[model samples]
Target: MRLEQWSRIMGKLAIDDEVLEEVAAAARSRGVSSESLAQELLLEGLRGHKSKESLRQLMEAIAAMTSRDVEQTDSVELLREDRDR
Candidate 1:
């Protein structure tokens, strides 16, 4: 979407130029338009704000997967282990 369209949709949120530049740089690095990246960030923020419990559950799931011990294994495997336990 065009910058003007994004501005119209986002209204008057005072984002600093330096932060905008960083967002643009990151978007470029990821091969996505800055507008799209900004939209994703906006949507993510909205979701987190509107339903913090959902976000908390998502974070917990991610942490469970990432912080699993060697013996713990993947979530699917963990589930099976739990069933057998």
Candidate 2:
């Protein structure tokens, strides 16, 4: 942990009263400040969102790499001709 991490920056956050109460209760239960708990939750949400975005990009790249164009062909005639040989 860094010394700057423990220092609070000057900013105001607007939160609903009910949500604030819930956060306060959770912080009390965990023996940490409500601000710290809120910060941790926000960080977790950001990480999860980034992971989902990375997975989506990877899937799109894989699809593009494996995609191919197909040409029309006479399947029944080709099979019959092959069987006769």
Q: Which candidate should be chosen as best, given lDDT against the real structure?
A: 1
Report, for all candidates in order, the number of backbone clashes.
0, 0
Candidate 1, residues 1-85, lDDT tens digits: the string is: 4445557877756677777888899999999988779889989998768477878998889887865455554799879999999
Give the lDDT of residue 22 in candidate 2.
89
The lDDT values for all models are 0.78, 0.74
- List the candidates' TM-scores in order: 0.46, 0.50
Give me the displacement of residue 54 in model 1, in angstroms.
8.0
The parts of candidate 1 lying over 4 Å away from their true place are 1-11, 50-85
lDDT computed for candidate 2: 0.74
What does candidate 1 score in Cα RMSD to the true structure? 10.1
Residue 32 displacement in candidate 2 (angstroms): 0.7
Clashing pairs in 2: none
